[model samples]
Target chain A: MPLDTSTYALAHLRLDGRRWNELRRLHAQISTQAAADGSSYLEQGNTKVLCTVSGPQEQKGGRGGARDQGNEAKVDVEMNIAAFSGMDRKRRARSDKRVQEMQVTIASAFQSTLFTHLFPHSTITVTLHILSQDGSLLAACLNAATLALIDAGIPMSDYISSVTVASAPSSDQSLDEMDPLLDLNGLEEQELPFMTVGTCGRGPGGGEEKVMVLVMETKVQMARLEAMLSVGIDGCKQVRGILDGVVRSHGKRVLESKVS
Target chain B: MAPYTGIPLSPAELSYLHTSLSQHPPIRPDARSPTAFRPLIAETDILPAANGSARICFADGTEAIVGVKAEVEKTPSASSHSINSHSINGEVADEGVRGLGSGGVRDVEDDGMDVDGGEDGKQSSKGRDEWLEVAIDIPGMRDDDALPVFLSAMLTEALLADGALKDKLYINTRFHWRLYIDILLLSLPLSYPLPLLSLTTHLALLATRLPALVSEKDEDPLFNDDWEASTHLYPPTKDETARQKPPITLLVMSVGENILFDPSREELAVADAVVAISVTQSHTNTTGPDADADADADSPNPLHLIALRTIDPPSRLTAAGLPNSLNTSAGAGAGAASQSLSSVEVAVTREKDQGVSVWRPPRGGVKRAVLARMIKMVVQAGGVGEEVLGGLRGVEI
Candidate 1:
């Protein structure tokens, strides 16, 4: 059945008012647990993520194959979306496509930056559990994952931050109606085609600039690729800045707690 | 190594293999020696909320955090008699004496004991003996099975052997104190050597500091003196003073025949065997036959000598003789080979009195020789000294 355009438009406007380019207010707390090797809880707008890291220990059997370089380590990434995390309830599946994709993306991002070869034949597993999802769930997960990694004291080339961009057909009929919006929420995502990008470090041009570590796009026109990419990259850079600030403040607080 | 025929190879893989095999002596592009360790960065007391905390980062991006919390509780009645009665008095003596008086006290005291000591009569019956529990959380790696429990057990053993906790101080006390050390590990790049990283966690505890406190109840029962003001307060005897600092543990991982100190996640990936060494300083009496002659002369600083030694090895695939088989064909023979290799032994040596050592594992053959040389080069590049090296040898893996 064809969807009602009018209702969708209203939802889109409401989401837009929430701000496409502006990130949701972020709150991060470090060292949330005593037993974990490292742990952090991150909330991005309505999206909440709790991340924990454990083990540079010997890699488990089956996971450590013969071809694995004796001196090369491996990373295992796991993402769990609670049954109540989404607006629509989700049933748990051990190997769902979406969950698997997230796992791969997270593993790739950490792999590129982490010095895995230092620990030979060992495995570092990062688990990200989403308690709630409003929109930009992946971006929020990445941010939480990085914080947890830092808390764990894992070495990294740099911190990775993510942002989502949506391209809506412009109302003006003359040109192809496609304008890039930043930091899309669930409502905005449902109305327009959008893409999410995760990037490292800060960017230039008053925001932050860095290459995209992972990119995922929903439906979108090929003609607007360049513009959408630009906006998405910019949004990522901005997100990185926010994440950087959060990490710095978190580290300071952790240190201060120890002294006090 | 033969390429698998079943799977199609990407251009990147083809080139990686070609270049890797073509290079003389077959060195990785990163130029790290076989046993070379990546950089290590450690921050102690990283978590302020924790009683004691530490975070260690390996160059390869593997990180682990450890927090120690101390809580007070009554010791088990069955074990109360085993506690050293000399250290505690008054209320403590009453509790210990009452618990030791009858087995009926076991029912009362058992409820107060922690869950871990429920089974052991010796451990559970004690009223004055304190217990330390170490919990390890590996974020995403925790399984419904035994992984979490295993990690906790490994850490607990390490902490006990760490020589940091003042077990003697808590003995015979009315309230038996238990120090809970919780470790949270995150990220852990896949390339890290699991055994080495676990060993690092063990070693990091060596630097953990415990407050120095001695009871003044013997000299000033009312606690009226400004503690330090009481001259009658007994100083920690030589033996007690020697136990003040925790023993330091150092971790060294070997790739093939080479040994590296404090291997990072990346460096651990290529290591063949990892060893942790823990060192402690003990005072030996100078009353031997030769001591009589030396006693007449001015003694040199009492010779508070430090000794280096090896701790228990951690459980790892490599340590278990199961070589990493990512590139190998799957079969029964491969499993057997892995089991055999798990027993491979690495060599270690103490280099100085500063509690460090230089380790040189036996080269299995010519192929391993290359790896050994590479590790040596990496250690040299890092400028690790005898103290650091020997310390690594003493850590409990």
Candidate 2:
């Protein structure tokens, strides 16, 4: 499992046969669970997640009681990993520091992107259940939650889309030849040091995107981080387009049903 | 009643429940008998990454999943001596750098030594408690919250009560298996979830298996390539009939003269007392009933008590019945001053008709008689403990 560039170099294709800057096939559906206020199911390659949004309701007896005194709705995230979701059946404790950290990261990412002031003295809970994990787990959860929130009809400043990018390992030591890979799968993720980048608010005339969420768990060369980040942001923009299309089409169907 | 109960019930509602439960044959809300549990959907050996895993869902939509993971960890004692020597060597190196009198070398050496020393300090600091870890996660609770913290501590205490599990973890002189029991509660805001969590943990532990060690005991433990060769953590007896397994805790609630098992949220709202009893399959009671009589005996095994404790019902924390002294005019605007005045008058009229009311939290502490009944229900043969252990044993892998 060391990054052996020889095989990838033979064909400019990644382990999954995708080229540089290519993304895995992403499939998403909104309002999947009728019981939830807002719910969505998303699949990126082998990574799949189901997200539900419940709230903007009264903050019951919880830690949010103190912090919610401000004029903003607290965004709470609860992430659950199915034991059968990964290559191995691993059960992540709800109190796991790593899982809790991811939950905090997702919560804070939306806390800034959503229009929380509109619903003060309340809490917006986003619960994510990871059905399958290939790679880019955190990124997939973010995208799934965004869709579910939109379905919940929660107003947000912009769509927060996330993707993973990694600097390709090269035989030569030159940094210029190091091409960054976009939307890596589980295998590539394990072999390469990658970062998950979430972008919000499309740049005016598509100039630059705002980085709302940037998380890198593995160490990589500082010079290569910029390359990986830029690629991830571009991937997020591409993801946003796909998510936008889904919402618009679903809206069209709803409109047609109403008119009839 | 205490306010912690997520669901609020009116005084009339609480009274009706208490009166009904006080009857000779308690009429449960769900119509289940005093000893009957809510129907549950359960599955075992469902998680691939875990050595053993189980998921259980109650009729009320409460779901709990437990995973048992075991990793071969190097015993710190094996490396503690080496770390001491390495630290001594670092000190010698530090002195050599200072004696050189070169600021460049001293700065670089100082930073490296500090990092090494820090890591060394942390490594040797961990106690024997590092061998086993148990964590519980409920959706809305923090890791340090009283409920999750207490649940984790109780689970750990029950697992280590007999020290058999720890002994099973011993791999060799240099290494041992580190066991992680991770429990996750899917549906949250539950008032009493201890029984659900404990049941899931019991099923998961019963299904757990350890990779067969192909390497010699003195050498680095090597696992066999064939996963089928793996052995169950709680294997059956030599006869391959009855299995030895971890303990399971049951939540029992008392209402007036009746003791209810697996009580629901509404039932707990008016409960007089609640207790959790932990039990494990007995090893010494081999001569117990039907031990030799039945050939294909799938009969319930004898269980021994591990731990028992009373849990405060969440309903006691809720605000007592309405018509209190608190005023409703606090949030009324100036524009609605006259309107608010009229509303206050209406409230006063109703209060006069109903008379002044005062509510206090339910009394604490369990009666000694109720406590004895709770224990008997769990530990007595053919009781709740036996029924649960037998049910898990019948689960098809």
TM-score on alpha carbons, each prediction = 0.40, 0.67
lDDT tens digits by residue: candidate 2, A149-250: 999999998889999998887656476668899998888988888899999977888535689899998888888887788788889999999999989988
Q: Indicate which candidate wins on DockQ.
A: 2
Task: Return the lDDT, model 1, position B345.
Answer: 26
Worst lDDT 10-window in candidate 2 chain B: B106-115
The lDDT of each candidate is: 0.51, 0.75
DockQ of 1: 0.03
Candidate 1, lDDT over the whole model:
0.51
lDDT for B87 in candidate 1 is 42
Residue by residue across B1-397, what tens digits does model 1's lDDT show? 3233222333234334334423455454466653344565665544323334455666555566655544445544424444443344533454332232221222311111223222322332333322665555454454343656754544444334322243432534344456555555555434423343354444444434333334442221122234234221112333332223333344555433344555443333334454433322222221345644553221211211112223222212121111223113455665445444332321111112111111111223223444333323322312332234333433321
Docking class of 1: incorrect
True contacts recovered per prediction: 0.00, 0.09
Task: Please tell me how candidate 2 rates in CAPRI terms.
Answer: incorrect
Model 1 lDDT per residue over A1-260, tens place = 23233433455443435444566778887766545677788887778777877777676555536446567667788886654356443335657898898888888888877787787778787878665677888888888888888888878777887777777655453357656777777767676677777877664433344564656556567887778777777777666667778778887886899999
**Winning candidate number (lDDT):** 2
TM-score, A chain, model 1: 0.85
**Complex DockQ per candidate:** 0.03, 0.10
